[model samples]
Target: MDQVNIEHTPPAVVEYLALRQIAGLSPMSREGAEIGLPNSLFAVCLREEDMLVGMGRVIGDGGCFFQVVDIAVHPDEQGKGYGKLIMSEIMKYLKENVPARALVSLLADVPADRLYAPFGFEYTSPKSEGMWWRQGE
Candidate 1:
């Protein structure tokens, strides 16, 4: 982990999309990335020697609601606690910035969802199911 740096900065557009693809997350269009990345409420970028290895972001209406999104760690870099590191940074930002009663949420994918539990995320199912829809569907 030499030269590992946790930057409170959004990754560049190309690296951002590449990391998502390499991490097996859904592919995002370039135009979408251009529009969305700048709107992040908070973002963390993990770099080793200045190369992007992992990242996470928070996005939502400023005060009332928030969601964690785009949590991706490169496959070659998995199992190194980078996910936890990213989440810790995000939690710190939320604690300091969001309103006390703001609704925070994330749509976790399993096994990886376990990573979020230690950070106090819990299942919202039964009470309400998570759902999604893409454009042109």
Candidate 2:
């Protein structure tokens, strides 16, 4: 945790996919990452001695809608406050760049949901529920 450096850039596609798998997030295709990572509104990569140990990203239209996504940390690196570190950089970007009317959102996988709360993210349920449709279901 001492020497982990924060880079305000997305991880390489290979590191992105590998970290997602190790962190237990749903798999994303390499093609998708190649297209998506460069389109990030903002991204943070936490590296210890140049090895990516954690990352997060914001993706959306420049003004209207933005989503906080791909929050992942290598299993060996979790619980050392790296997730919070990633989110902190993300929140800084949002505060500086996003308009007040722009909506920022994320789907939190439980327990991890706790990590997002202090950053001011909240549930949009009952009033509005989260639903999804997969490409090849």
Candidate 3:
């Protein structure tokens, strides 16, 4: 594995879609990406020589509530610490920017919960559960 460069730049919609599909994440429509990405409070992208191999973003109302989302890395590039790289940058942003007592959350996908534990993310079940409502559903 070559050296990967992580940048505080959001991925373009095309690269975002490609990374999500390759990472086995659900797809997001182009219009959705266009509207949502620009609203990110902070975003990081990992590049290996010019390829967008990994990305993550923090989105929310930008003060009291924030969510860590869109964490993805190319399948071929997994296990190379790219996810950690992305998370580290995102965490740094959160720690520096978000106020104390602010609520930060993320929907950890099964096994990926382990990835977030070190960053102070814990299960919010039993007392409260994570839920979402799809647009047409």
Candidate 4:
């Protein structure tokens, strides 16, 4: 495989939504992407030629709390270490920007959690659970 280009840049709304679909992730609305991407504390985009193939972002208050989100890679590009490359860039940002006691978290979808373990993520399990508020529930 040829070298993949990874950069500290966020994807546009169209590319962001498309990558989510390709990666089997939940869809984000156009307005959501428009508002959200700019607010990211750190973001990385992987490209092969002119195509956006992978992306990840860190979002949260600048201090005390941060969450790793939107980690996705194109289906055709899966198993190629792009996810780890994305995470490494995000982790680098966290290591430099977040304070020692600040909380960093992510909602790992099943097996993907394994990819994060080496970066020091652990299950919050019985001590504390991860939760989200749905639109109606």
Candidate 5:
């Protein structure tokens, strides 16, 4: 996968949201309609000739913390460093805008944590924990 173009589009924010809905792992979907919208979070996608190959984003409170969510690369594009690309882009944004020691977090899914670790994302184990609020009963 050579020559991937990463675009930070304001109007295309919905792409990341839609992809998350497809991935079906984030709290946004479980949180229901009032909570999740097209642009509630900041998003970025990797495109190779107009096709969305990968994406990730930072969501949550601007003052206290942020969650790195929606990290996904299309099935056909996986194992090609696309995941790292997405992580790098998202981390870059956080580094530039977030204040020092502002607690940037992400819920790693199994082996995916390997990619995130090198980007300075540590497991919140021993000192802390990670949990979620699921929807419905």
Candidate 6:
């Protein structure tokens, strides 16, 4: 596997979202607008041969807390640590860019939680449970 070519930019972000949609992690249309890139997201993207391979994003409040969202890698490119590479960069950014005491959270997808464990993330459960009330649910 080739080393991941990571970047934070419009094109890279669009690529990331497209790959995430393909991975079934993102809504198919995003309200009929793919303006995710160069719009408001800050992304850590991995690309090869103009192909979007992997990426992760930080979304939500600019301060206080942020959700680690949309981490995805193309199926053909999953075993090469590309997702880890994207995650590592996102974590690094949170550590360096966000305030020291700010909270960062992610909805881990099963085995993927193990990847975040090494980054000092732990279960909030057994202490405090997670709850959500989506707009329509």
TM-score-best of 4 and 5: 4
Task: Give each model's whole-structure lDDT.
Answer: 0.92, 0.92, 0.89, 0.91, 0.72, 0.72
Residue pairs clashing in model 2 are none
Q: In terms of lDDT, which candidate is stronger, 1 or 5?
A: 1
TM-score of 6: 0.82
The C-alpha TM-scores of every prediction are 0.96, 0.96, 0.96, 0.95, 0.79, 0.82
In TM-score terms, candidate 3 sits at: 0.96
The model with the greater lDDT, 4 or 6, is 4
Which scores better on TM-score, 1 or 4? 1
Off by over 4 Å in 2: none
Q: lDDT for model 3, please.
A: 0.89
Model 3: residues >4 Å from true position, as ranges?
none
lDDT of 4 by residue, 39-86 (tens): 999999999998998999999998999999999989898898988999
Mind giving the per-residue lDDT tens digits that candidate 6 earns over 1-137? 69657787534444555776787774534442355444444677678967777777787677888888778888888789887787788878787778878888888878778888888889998998877764441
C-alpha positional error of residue 128 in candidate 1 after TM-score superposition, expressed in Å: 0.7
lDDT of 5 by residue, 55-128 (tens): 87677787578888768887777889998888777878887878776878888888777988899878778898
**lDDT per residue as tens, model 3, 13-132:** 899988898899988898999998888999999998999989999999988999999999888888988888888899889989999899999988988878998878889879899999
Pairs with backbone N, CA or C atoms under 3 Å apart (clashes), candidate 5: none
Worst 10 residues of 3 by lDDT: 128-137
Per-residue lDDT of candidate 2, residues 79-103 (tens digit): 8999999999999999999997889
